[model samples]
Target: SQTIHQWPATLVQPVGSPLSLECTVEGTSNPNLYWYRQAAGRGLQLLFYSVGIGQISSEVPQNLSASRPQDRQFILSSKKLLLSDSGFYLCAWTNRETIYEQYFGPGTRLTVT
Candidate 1:
């Protein structure tokens, strides 16, 4: 069975501070990884996606960046968080052969003060 894990279920940070969030998957290999942000009462917006190590596709250009250094590890980082960066961050994975569905782990809600 495949499972995903993300840390720091909730975060509060001052505006202009740095941010780092991590996500990892188990029981799968070479899965397509994606980072999505959802504001309160809104749908998810894709931030970044990785098809392989060092290969990331950015869906939006903003105050966020993503990296995949290993097969199952994906990281989201920001140099200086903005007030607009406050939202729920989610990490998801989908099997390369199956694009119809994506599995999301527990998300991290971030508040930029």
Candidate 2:
């Protein structure tokens, strides 16, 4: 079975600090990776996506950035955190063969104070 993992399941930080979140997948190759954020009581917003190594697409206008450092590994990072950046961050994966299907990790809830 395939699995996706996200680390530091929860985080709380003050304004203006750096942030780094990691996501990785097992049992799959060349999978499409995606980063999403959901505000409290709001729908999910697609932040960034990678179809392959070094191939990333931003879905919206946001300060967040995503990178595929290696196959099966995607990283989301920010040089400085913003209060509005606080949200539930999720990492999801899907393959070209199963474009309609996606698997998501438990997610990381971030709070900026």
- Residue-level lDDT of model 2, residues 29-99, one tens digit each, is 99999999999999989999999999999988767788998989999989889999999999999988999
Candidate that would win on lDDT? 1
By TM-score, how accurate is candidate 1?
Answer: 0.98
Per-residue error (Å), model 2, residue 67: 0.7
Poorest 10 consecutive residues of model 1 by lDDT?
61-70
lDDT tens string, model 1, 1-113? 99999988999999999999999999999999999999999999999999999999999989799999999999999999999999999999999999898999899999999
RMSD of each: 0.6, 0.7
For each candidate in turn, the TM-score is 0.98, 0.97
Candidate 1, 104: how far from true, in Å?
A: 0.2
What lDDT score goes with residue 26 in model 1?
A: 99
Model 2 ranges with Cα > 4 A deviation:
none
